[model samples]
Target chain A: MTSMDFLLLTKGPLFQIAIAIFALGMLVRLVEIFALGRPHNYAAARGGQLIPGLKTVYKRFNPDPGTFKRAPFDVIVGIIWHIGFVVALLLFIPHIELIKSMFGVTWPGLPNPVVDAVTAITLFALLATLIHRLTHPVKKFLSTPEDYLIWTVTFLPVLTGYLAYHRLINPYPLALGLHILAAEIFLIVLPFTKLTHIFTAFVARWYNGAIFGRKGVQS
Target chain B: MTEFSLERGLNALREEMDAPVASFFSSCVHCGLCATACPFYVETGDPKYTPIHKLEPMRLLWEQEYTLWGKLKSKLGLGKQVTDEMLEEWEPLLYDSCSMCGRCSMVCPVGNDIHYMIRKAREGMVASGHAPEGLIAASVRAVNTGSPMGLQWKTLDVQIKHVETATDLEVPIDKQGADYLVLLSSMEIINFPEYLEAITKIFDHAGVSWTLSQQCFEATNAGIQIGSKDIAATLVQRVVDAAESLGVKNVISPECGHAYTAIRWEGPNAIKRAYPFKVFHIIEVLDQLRAAGRIKTEGKEMDRLSMHDPCNLARKSGVIQQQRSLMDLVADNFVDLEEHGKFQWCCGAGGGVSSNERAEELKMAAFKRKKAQIEQVEPERMVTMCATCRTQLEEGLEEFNMDIPVVGLTEMIADHLVERDKPDDAAAKAGG
Candidate 1:
């Protein structure tokens, strides 16, 4: 088979399989949250009604929204970091083309240089957070193998893609090919690790604000 | 005032936390979202004043003495030891700034329980003897003399005499078998007499048999505020013993925020079990009485009623619903503050702010959030469920030079009672 034919057959099938894996992983994650949030009858009474179920969430719920909201900076930084991350993820041409091919759709495109630069900056910014996690003594307890691995795995494709785009190596095709593979793996891994936080953060925050507001917690 | 000795004492206290509960304290992510909910953070605009930052001393101690990685950091001077000099920073940051209101913990995404975290930090401060001398003196008085103000029995009698003169209603005293044993904090008897008078006015109007005990009255519990659990429990034990000895069926907590917490929540736990007698915050009592149509009140003329829930009775306790229930009776226009419940802003006086003289500026600054919230109402009066809140808000409004009256939840209830006859002034105004 010609190189293009091999690329079409091998990369195309691998990508589809990777897509299925991503969907399944997401399903498992949603199931886990659904199980946790099934609304057990026991979580009804709150410690204080003024904050509207806030007391109960503290006493009864496993992770209270009120408790986590204390560090607004971490929340704000985490959000800015994640928004840039998702936009970078969707705009990468190979992944976007792959997604379009699977779904039989297309969206307007970004210039190659612009997309690569964004991918490099965002992934590096996330990499900096990872390095800070490993080094900061205060953050040491919060650090886990998963924390390091997830960010490293997330950055791999961006790193490889940046290397390919920058024309740093002789075999640009090989680097780009490896980058495509890593992107496939990362796309599949999104729902399984800390990335689940991306989907959960909004649901958690808005749900909390609404519930507490109605209970007349927020005047 | 900052003390040199307190500096050393604070270091000693930090050492204790390092030895025992450092694991619990060091665990936090500094997300600034909690600042939006914190009155202290709002007033100071200092990230360190936010609830998450309140744990920094403890976090520093944890790093220096515990966790292998922290121990490594300590060796490199990256992690500063909790030395005598550090107390200079920790004292005002922890005591003056924090109200122990638990609002940050309420909003925390990780369920950090910043209240307990702050309390643990305070435990370090308390053990170091870094707490306000007045609080220590008063709590010691409470331990030895059975009250915080250290009032003599004769003075207690004089106050009862005053209550008689004001209401023409007798408070059951040292009498066994009364239907209710009404508890007052030292603030009510020693500072504000009208709160006790309000209780009497309601009891007279409702015909409930209530009595004051010369043996056990004042309910202020500094132990809880300062994070000394033992002293907190002792504060509760006094009320439990008095009620048990007097054979009272119900224990009514005065409007003091910390006092209500000591009695209603920690009091039962302090007694090594729950008491058979029901614990009712004054607002809860008024609410039930109003709902049953047992008490009559003359509603205030103000159209807009903004009720601020004291953290103790509202966020700290679950009786915030009663604030609204009572508010429903007080005015035609009731605007709920959005950041109101467990989310409600503290009057900055709830966690022993009234007694900490050094905390006066912090208290006033903390009250700025509540004051701002009320200013939005453009109301005739602001109603609150705590005596300390009334005190804090009243003084806070004056400090900011705003002309709003701060009244108690019970006072509002009494005003809105149906049995209240329209004043003669109403008739004169009608004729005019």
Candidate 2:
């Protein structure tokens, strides 16, 4: 297919299919987790759980002092990439416009230059994490094939989008088509891989908080 | 009894597959931050000691049985099964290296309770006949002889008599309607008879009615360390039965971390019923007495003192402030380790590691983390509330040739207690 035809295919039916699989897959995974159903704590609680559970959902974004001191680079780069990725995905004008087209909703977007700088920084941070994962002994040992695979799928959308936006690739349609295809692939693979952490991290944090909170700890 | 096998182990893991475990495994991103939080990995620099990696067998079983992708893979013969051999290889990882300290759980960016998973994973290890022999023997002794160390009530009775003679105070036994029913660990009975004396003096001074039961004086639960709920429940039921029969208002867990965790937190859940009375760690009780203006003290210890927070007590049970409050009551120069309270490094002897003879070298290796923390502070003496932590601290410091002595917070508090007047002096002074 020509570049224009390829762009049309990605933005039209392929995007819808990708979104469907992404949503349904994540739903099933969440159901599987929740259906397991934690047993009721028969022991008396020393503190309230609901507030602590909610607190931990937000608190875990920042690393504890010991953890940060132990692995400063990992914590700093992890925070930077996460914040940069979200900003680039949601605050860029074209992405917001795409979302508006898909869901009939729109929000004000950041200036193109600002979004561009964030995407570049995010790409660098992702690369740094990948290198760390490959070199850090514990991370290297813990990593599986899925870890590298997930990292690539996560990295490609940002890398290709930045390239397409700057028109670094030769043909505009070809670069744009590649970017959209990369994002669609990301969505399809996300719920199936460790990337499910995007949603389940909150659940995990809540459980951790509730368990410790019942014992009057702010974990 | 049926012999332990891989099938039983897999079944046990299946039983442990609850929502928290599922969420924790799903949320993990293999960042290996848990290793940084674990003392075993921090001290030995071994990637194999990573907290999440230690739960590999249980995690594999969870994936194969619970998830769609894992099920599909298993059906196609592409899934990894938890084999007996795999569990055998993992015994040290699960039992020797881990103290169930929960620091990893605290530092996991995604909030995976890695220590909780380790505790559950041990259930599988024991069922598969892969548990360390020391832990198995301890569990057996605890179940049969009522103490993991195989000490009898007569052993504790002798300590009680010694404490009564030393302090010249009554040592109440099976005193019905007492305010507190005290439990003791075998470590305290054998290694630190002074614990009984300190409590006796403090109780007498505070006018608190307390007694020790002849039936179930032992508080440490081997089942808890061995990761067997059935055994844990049986041990817990013994304490429950003893307390109920005595009709005490509360049960006091002695200066042992796992004992406090066992009876105070896990006891009710293990037996599937709420406790008729309450449970408190000795520090918590002392703190309460201090707060209520019941226990009066006259002096502060001048030594440069620091504390070792027990994992089960500080991190797991949230008894952090109680020990600190008790310390403040008697310690004038108390310095905290760089890492204390819920984030403190474990003494490396908890969760049955001290019981497992094979884990001796590993336990010392883990103690290096705590040793480093102590070296940073350079305290003259280290104080702690848990008996197991105290023992480990004493042994580890001696092993390293550190001059810092270890003391129990309770005993220290007892030493500083204001001496009360005799009945004759009180009456004569009132008349004058």
Task: State the lDDT of candidate 1 residue by residue for A1-219, as single tens digits.
Answer: 544554454378877887787778666644443443321112122323335334433442233344345444345445545655666667767668866977878776677777866766676577667665665433443444656667777778767767867877545556566767777778776654555445444333333333333323431
Q: lDDT tens digits, residues B93-129, model 2? A: 9999999999999989898989889888988888878
Location of the lowest summed lDDT over 10 successive residues in candidate 2 chain A = A38-47
| Every candidate's chain B TM-score | 0.85, 0.97
Candidate No. with top TM-score = 2
Q: How accurate locally is residue B415 in candidate 1, as Cα lDDT from 0 to 100?
A: 45
In angstroms, the error of model 2 at A150 is 0.3
In order, the Cα lDDT scores of the candidates are: 0.65, 0.90
Local error of candidate 1 at B429, Å? 23
Of candidate 1 chain B, the 10-residue stretch with the lowest lDDT total is B18-27
The top-ranked prediction according to lDDT is: 2
Superposed by TM-score, candidate 2 places the C-alpha of residue B341 at a distance from the truth, in angstroms, of 0.6
